[model samples]
Target: MTALTLIRHATILLELAGQTFLVDPMLDDARSHDAVEGTSNPTRWPLVGLPTGAAEVVASATAVLITHTHVDHLDDTAIAFLRDRSVPVFCQPFDVAELTERGLPDVRPVDEVTHWRGVAIRRTGGQHGTGAQADLMGPVSGWLLTHGGQQVYVAGDTVWCDEVAAVLDVNQPQVVVVNAGEARMVTGDPITMGADDVFATCRYPGRRQVIAVHLEALNHCGLTRAELACDAAAAGLEVTIPRDGERVSLFQG
Candidate 1:
């Protein structure tokens, strides 16, 4: 069985491929990080408090999967916590050197398809935003996790573009989780899935589960949970927006 528990922000405790994979852990107390400069809201990041203890969040995690090394995704506190544990840390090839330097002993890079244990982890492309903003944000990745005839796609920090469409068309994953918040910088467009993009994803011509995350925690993420829920209802579409620390099943087999 594959399931996901949203710890906070983009921090997801994913039970997949027969292991409990801690994905993009930003394990910090609320308002620990400074607010993004020039963002619309100058509020300190992680607006809400953690739903549970941070230790409880990492207790059962057998492995770690990082979409990127961005601070919001992997904070300094998480680094300290991970530095103590020697679990397998999976990431894109671009991040191997950095993670290794951070005292992570087992930094495994998933270049395209990596077979760990018995499951397959496929690294997929993502664009943080369009044109210059995307370039500035550098390279990020999505993931395709397959095992036991079940597939779960985690669309990390990306706007709806060819890369996302390709994943939907080709992989045909049973559960698709997109990082939606319409998170924006001062000048550019949203760096993550906005309302329209998420609606497009849900309305995609297929019977797949669409779950939205990466919302409400950060200051830059303008999309609120209530707003997204209202929009989803108005559009008559289905999208699972799990609360912080809430667990939801994405795929089961």
Candidate 2:
């Protein structure tokens, strides 16, 4: 059985096959940072407040997995919290130096596959955007975990691209976690998964269940949960969009 807790935005607590994985910990109050150059620059971002048991959730994390160095994904508060604990931090090779420089001494850069507690943690390439836009978005990564006869794919802040298709084709994760907020800048198209991207991922071959996160917390995100649900229904996908502090499991009865 797997327990997935959607803390807020991109932060997720995944407990699968007795191993607990914390993916992208953005631990702090809403509006903690300034808005990006483009996008809805509200006086404060994260329109909503922090989840109920945020501190406890962070404390319960067995291991931390970071996909990128974006502030929204790895905030100062999370870094402080993680530093106090003795858990191992897994991230892409590029982010190893930055995180280690940030005082996280136990950071481990995962190039290909790493083993932890009998689970296989693998790294995959991602296209944060297309063409020149991708360059601007910087380096990002997706993660795949195989355990307990199940494969889970955590698609980081990326759009629908060949890299994503390759991950799906090669890994064929049964449970797919997508950052679906349709987040866009004031200038270009959405940088995150939009309705079309969500539909495409849900319809991908061999994907049994899809979980969508990274919505409603930030001002830049234009897609709402209701809107994504409508689009998923239209695409015939029964996706799970958990709210803040909500938990959804992948175990079948």
Candidate 3:
């Protein structure tokens, strides 16, 4: 049995093929920092607290996977936590230098197919947004983890675009993890997956499971689980909406 636990926002604990990975950990407590400079909702960060046992989850992880270096995804608190451990961190090439400069122990760039602890891993491409917004958001990466007969794709911080479609077409993963918070800035469009994007991804022609996360913890993230669930159902898409601290499992036959 493989399990994915939604700890909060973009942080996830994925236990697959007898190995554990902690993805994009933001373990800071509520109101830890100022909100994005210009976002309409300028309240202090993390509208909610870190889930119980969040520290334990960090300590138990066999490795760390980071999609990007945004504060909401990889905060100072999480960096400190990782600095104290001896775990390896897998991330996109762009972030390798930054993480290493931050004093993380073993920061490995996922430039190609790599195997760690019996699992096959591939780094996938994604655009944070289009045009100017994309420039501001910078580069991000998704990950494909395959072990045994099951494949899981973690589609990190991307909107609906041709790259995402290509990933779906080429990988055909059994499970797709989506960031569906619809986070936006004060002047630009949404920077992350909204209900529309999530609905579209889930409607792809397959029986795969969609795990919708990255919702409701931050002030700028306007999308809610109830809202996405309603919209997804209307669009004939099935999604697993896990609350903060909820755990869900996938089995490989």
Worst 10 residues of 1 by lDDT: 244-253
Candidate 1, residues 1-253, lDDT tens digits: the string is 5789998888998897679989998988888878887687889978988788777777778888899999988888888888888789899899999998988888999889998877888999999999999998989998888897788889999999889889899888889989999999999889999899999888777668988999999999999889999999999998899999899976542
TM-score for candidate 3, residues paired by index: 0.96
RMSD of 1: 1.3
1 or 2, which is superior by lDDT?
1
Q: What lDDT score goes with residue 144 in model 3?
A: 94
Identify the runs in model 2 with alpha carbons over 4 angstroms from their true place. none
Which run of 10 residues does model 2 get worst, by summed lDDT?
37-46
lDDT of 3 by residue, 76-149 (tens): 88888889899999999889889999999999998977999889889988878777998888989989999977
Q: Supply every candidate's count of residue pairs whose N, Cα or C atoms clash at under 3 angstroms.
A: 0, 1, 0
For each candidate, C-alpha RMSD in Å?
1.3, 1.4, 1.3
lDDT of each: 0.88, 0.85, 0.88
**lDDT (tens digit, per residue) of candidate 2 on 130-189:** 777778989999899998678888999998888888888887877888999888877777
